[model samples]
Target chain A: MKSLLQNLARWLVPVCFIAFSFSEEPYQLKLAMSWGSDFPVFSESPKRMAERVAKMSNGRLTIDVIGSEEHGRPLDVFDMVRNGEYDLGHSASYYWKGKVPNTLFFTTMPFGMLPLEQYAWLEHGGGQALMDEVYQPLGLLSLPGGNSGSQMGGWFQKRIKNTESLNGLKMRVPGFAGEVLSELGVVPTNIPATDLYEAMSRNVIQAAEFVGPSTDFNLKLHLAAQFYYTGWHEPGAELQFLINDEVYQSLPADLQAILKAAMRASAYDTYVHSVDVSAQAWADMRRQFPTIRVKDFPDEVMSELRRVNERKLVEFADDNDQARRIIESQLGYQAMMRNWTLLSDYSYLESIGR
Target chain B: MKSLLQNLARWLVPVCFIAFSFSEEPYQLKLAMSWGSDFPVFSESPKRMAERVAKMSNGRLTIDVIGSEEHGRPLDVFDMVRNGEYDLGHSASYYWKGKVPNTLFFTTMPFGMLPLEQYAWLEHGGGQALMDEVYQPLGLLSLPGGNSGSQMGGWFQKRIKNTESLNGLKMRVPGFAGEVLSELGVVPTNIPATDLYEAMSRNVIQAAEFVGPSTDFNLKLHLAAQFYYTGWHEPGAELQFLINDEVYQSLPADLQAILKAAMRASAYDTYVHSVDVSAQAWADMRRQFPTIRVKDFPDEVMSELRRVNERKLVEFADDNDQARRIIESQLGYQAMMRNWTLLSDYSYLESIGR
Candidate 1:
């Protein structure tokens, strides 16, 4: 009878191995996104990622995406994901600069690399390793979520002609860019997106900086401001996906690959979608509001802003070694990439006469 | 006794179903590529796609990639895939122009939209549907494989200051751009990659148009040529992945999704890789050879080339209804996208004086 039981155990071991190899256990992960439920392209990114994950994983891995409206913690995505309250979160890295100073350089900067250039830096120029170094200590893994392309600097009630025009000017520009503006005597303010239109219409703010045409058109800021300045700050703002290291590690190898591939494809799709929507929206806005005038900030003002920007960057890099390394990496890569950009796309556009 | 037999059969059916559900068969696919095995980013794209598919599918699907060097057929990828001789092919749409004239517009056109703009048109504009219309009739499915970004025009032995300089110019340029140049009395030739350096050095060809810095620097063209021209043709050349439709449909749903996600991610990565490599190669070349001069064709030459290109496009459109529709779609979208490009990235770059 004992010999019979041992033989049965030997037979069952191979059976269990075969079943385990073929029948993967299903995993369900929850994702939090930093947008409202109804947000157009922004909301669509994580949803697309989830759908791809489900399809590619053969229903073995499913991701449930919830917007900030449902989660009620738009600004706390980093904290939530790091603490393992959620498996993942989609938000811009710069939003967490207050908590992790090194996070600021991962998004975009004043007069920074464009979308492709920034992507090149992240994927090939040690930017990803630096990013991991900063996030790993906090128990988080981050991937690029999407890009907003080059942003529009702001909408202004009056054109900025000189450095003096910025003096005592009130505007709603947030983050590092706002700090740079304040150096030029602009009174930078931050307001909720919901209040932007009302603030501009009621003269609560003299100028407002928001995203480009796609999202900005939703707020109807064009009706309130006549002069639209092209982007100087946030040249190519990239959003990020934050995952808890433990949750990521707990997945099977195949599921991990599926999650990463889905996230990457969705991020790229979002950028392409932004480009499409922004083009259509800009064309529509200009057609309806024929009086809208696009202006570039004057050379004098731009030079002063660049000067102040350099000063602030140096000051920020003084204390923290990680911050200093990140800034230097970006600056050095930007210089090399900008040279190529000037030779290729920049030259092509110029020769064609925009 | 018959009733007992029937009961036994019914019991065995459920057990068979459970085992079948837990054990999936592995699938293998064969892919043919246009480039040689040593080709840098171009060859890497399909290889990367195969790797991701294997990982994401947990070894359920494996792809074997064959390059032109091994297959001895560089331009027959479309036909091979369609005929089921190969399950997939990595090539460019423009290569099929001889067989299907409409395939020409899917790849980059002379003086067409840049990379992101073209991607937007393909994804959000009607480009993909149109591409499907062209390829579906041939029993193939196509996806964007990768982009070379904006290519440098070509290496020139002499600076071309006017259209007259192009008369009897023995240059090796290919495809529709070559056709356009032929109108200006330039003799456009096609030479094998192995002979490009020798041809240019021996005065067998006064100029040659190849891919940009990353690939071009490999041929040592700068050693023989003094002037490098920025691209007027192939602004954003996108390679394609062609799959046999029936073979694609044969895959289980999850494997199908994995294949597509892998391709998409690999394609985007290839583009990012190109941007990085090109930037690094260009910087290195300049540092090593400071004498290489980069030039843009003068306005006289550019306007004339544009005029000829338009004429050819019109002539080509007249013959085929599908061709006309595709060209019109591109033109319409380009008109709208160019406006946004001018307002956003173009404006920002000009403001910075790169």
Candidate 2:
């Protein structure tokens, strides 16, 4: 009897193995983001990304995404994801300045570097290594996302008469920009997502900043402010992607390549959205919100601010070695890119003006 | 003299106004993030949010914090902020899945969904609206930034003879219960930082998973097996902050409240970093790496996969609206989430898993 049972077990295992080997498991994936469908990040990028990745993987893996509002509030995303509540999430960095100060360098700085320069530093410099160092402690890895090519100055409710006007002014700003504003005597503030519209509409703040015209138009800034500013401070900005450390390490190398390709698609989408939508959004705002006023910053104002920006850099370098290193690297790159820009993009614009 | 002065006056009038108004130019803002920061989303409970917000706001309205790795790779952050870049950026969102496919949801998904129920529903429900809705044509808004909760099952080296055979497999694992491996097949692959020494030894990997102690000790698997298996769809994920659009609309009344006292401070230094270095990071992974083996999956493995999981709601609903609602909501959310996930995250995971 025992011999017969053993023989049966061996055959059963082998038979099952042969049958299962020929089949594949149904696969599915999940993605989480803090923003809603209206947000350009996911609408323009993630959706397309899902389709491309699926095709590349031959349907072996499938994905599903949940927006921030659908999952949790914007702030809850990090914890939810870390806790394994969501497979993926889309978010920002400054929101967590309390935990890692160094992270600020990657996000943005007051009079820091421009988008192109920042990208150079991140890809070639030790930025990725440094970032991993911080995240490793938490079992996470990171990747690059999208980039907004420079941004316009924020909207204004009142015009300035002099530098003195900046004193005691309440402003909504983040990162290094806030520090720069502080130097000019402006008080900076930070608020959550839901409350922004209410605060701006209710007069809780004197000045505020969001993104570019496309985004601003969506938020209906035209109804609240009178003046639109130019883009001199933030020439460009990049987005990012994060991963759980253990999970990332487990992925096959080829899969990693596919992921990179998908991300590139998303980035392209964001870029195109910004370019295609900004002009139209602005035009619409002009027609719908006639009260809105658009204008550029005076060259003199830009020049003086640029001087202050230099001073701020010196101050930052004085305290931290990393800051000094970053500044030096950034400036060096800027010098190199200066000629590149002048010869490439700038020349075309100049000729058009003529 | 009057005629000559009139000519000078015309040009001087506009130049003087620009120069004088330069002081009043809208303040620039930049938001940043790091994986380790303690933020409003992932750090302390909501009860503690007020105090932190108060400190940063100094009695004014506070900036909202969605600090974590919700956006993209921590390294790419600088790019997002530099170009007027992103006014704010979170830590890392699946390391740029938006730009990379397979990697997109890996930051958070794998098994998908855990941490706290409250957070899970938030993401699966309308919470995404709070962040995504606010960021549109412009390139900005807030995002998830906190998380460190549930995780994936981990990888294994050897094929399982049965569900119980998950034992004795070699595997690489981190966080939570990496300590419990004695009863399981795992040999445990404990590699050190950077070097991941034990894993480099490549002794096993027959079957492994360390996130749960069962896989940790059993997989001592990194040393023993050739196959690695795990259920960890998502290990500890995090939220990220996104801020490009809001930073642009600096003039809206409600927008101004977006940046203020304690909240801003909470988002930056205090809240952002703490979450990354949670207690889980303090555990060691060295003891398990010595004797793991690797393994592979056999044919006809598990049955009732897609059909079972896909119809899970119908089976579990039990005629209750609430039950149906839960399943329906999950399905609905998954439907939306899948559109993008399939295109990017799913394919990436599969490509690598293969």
Candidate 3:
């Protein structure tokens, strides 16, 4: 009788749980990415996250990823996820700044913190909560997808010696950086990514800023330009993962934990991968293109850019309460953290003569 | 009869699988940590990793962590895990250099690559394979546990202006860095963590290097020494997680996946957490202790230290084939990556004057 009861109990447990708990039926999610199918590191991050989630969950949850080439709306990821047309999105938050003003702060800003510093702000210094405040109202959730590390300033056809060199210069820069460049008398022109190389080659634009060496090398920018400038704008540009609140809330507790863990691991993996890719690409570029000279904008030009950036930020914050709050928070955190950065990485690099 | 057979099939499937698979039985592993129970970030990392594993596995796999205070063998974690006395260990790889010569390269080196650079090597540039060559023979598996960011050089009672200033200076610094300092005429002493504060206060040791501000502030070294110097040694010190290969192989595939994902997430979290903690602590120290001045060793002294460090590395590599291979790999990878670092983060910092 005792042996029979034990067998009966084991059988009853699996039967009841399997039938009622909904664990047997797999939950499928659709993810849309802003990057095209062939995009290297950018497209790989979301796919890696999805793969990890599936394995970790033992196939209980699966995510089907569709890149921009299939979706035909690279920039519509935000709306697709928000409206439940897609369950998740992989894109940059700043890409939505035109639709939502506060979205810009989540990505890298001109003269902003580096990758680790920005991560500190996001994880510990109230940046995440502020981000939640903005996204929660739209019934959306956002997670840091990955970082591109620090981007280079741009590729210039000629050396930028002073502020005068920037005046009347036609450059294909984008977004907030374009605005800042326009303030300095440079004509910031918007050109399709495909046309960027031709524009520069034909003297339609004298300079152009794409990503760092890893992605920019694909555009053959080094062949058209002799000077590669150091980065100021888009230092540690972070991409984001967007999820519909309803879709996320409907998942089981364990699945939620699994998804978050997978996202976190993949996000970090992408950053480390980017560092390796960029290092290798930069090395290759230097070896192949001996004429490409790395340059820094003159101190006077850098100072003028900083001054203009600060003024533009003030004007941006003056109108919106949420924008003001975010700007103030970022400024305060940057002030506090910058001292540590100066003492740690900056000092170490200086001592080594990098 | 057909309907009855269909119903019976469903019930029998769950019963047979659940009973035969033994999925209900839990796998519990014990982890021994090198840090004391009260140690802040170091102790917290393994605990967080264990918690995530438990949640993600839905309690099928659990880890019981015992710190050094409980185990009474802080430096014996590598042996303990290897002998299967503990299934896992949380410690730094360099701690085992005396027992295994190749273990030294797995951790940070003096004037070596920074955290991200080292991580890039481990993840992409053939580092993990080399590490496996050393550890796999011992029936051990190692994973990156956490990073301490950039460590400050040390706290000094007097300014170190040149090589002469280092002569006859008694300092508490340990391991390979101490060996380098000894060559420069500085007396390197090892003091217990509990006794370092008193040793500095009584002038038993005129200077000491613990960690950066996050951990160092806890020792209150700033109160005894007013001069804080920037780092040259252990730029980005990474810790390790060691697992018994036999124990790891005993786990189910899904559980194995869960454990790896959890460890990866927690390790990155600890690094991001350390940046925030160090920044906050450094800010607090500045506000509370106005007289604590941060200093950098003069260029002559820095150059001398570098020369000695390079010589010592050559001596270290001369005897062991594995050590030579790791050293060569690190040097080559650093040469390739440093250019990217300079063009990216270093230039960005200089442009902002940080």
Better of 2 and 3 by TM-score: 3
Candidate rank order under lDDT: 3, 1, 2
Residue B205, candidate 3: alpha-carbon lDDT: 94
Greater lDDT among 2 and 3 belongs to: 3
Number of residue pairs clashing in candidate 1, backbone atoms closer than 3 angstroms, sequence gap of 3 or more or interchain: 1
lDDT value for model 2: 0.47
Worst 10 residues of 1 chain A by lDDT: A16-25
Residue-level lDDT of model 3, residues B1-354, one tens digit each, is 655655665656666455534535789999999998778888888999999898888888899999898999999999999999999999999999899988999989988999999999999999999999999999999999989888999999999878999999999999998989998899999998778889999999999998999988889899889999999998888899999999999998888888888889888888888888999999999999989999888999888889999998898789888888899999999999998988899889888775
Sort every candidate by TM-score, greatest first: 3, 1, 2
Kindly report which residue stretches of model 1 are placed more than 4 angstroms away from their true locations once superposed: A1-25, B1-23
Candidate 1 is scored at a TM of: 0.94
lDDT of 1 by residue, A166-251 (tens): 99989999988899999999999999887999999999999999999998888999989999999899888899989999999999
- Give every prediction's interface RMSD: 7.4, 33.7, 3.7
Identify the leading candidate in terms of TM-score. 3
Candidate 3 docking quality: incorrect, acceptable, medium or high: medium
For candidate 2, the TM-score is 0.45
* Candidate 2 or 1, higher lDDT: 1
Q: DockQ values for all predictions?
A: 0.40, 0.01, 0.53
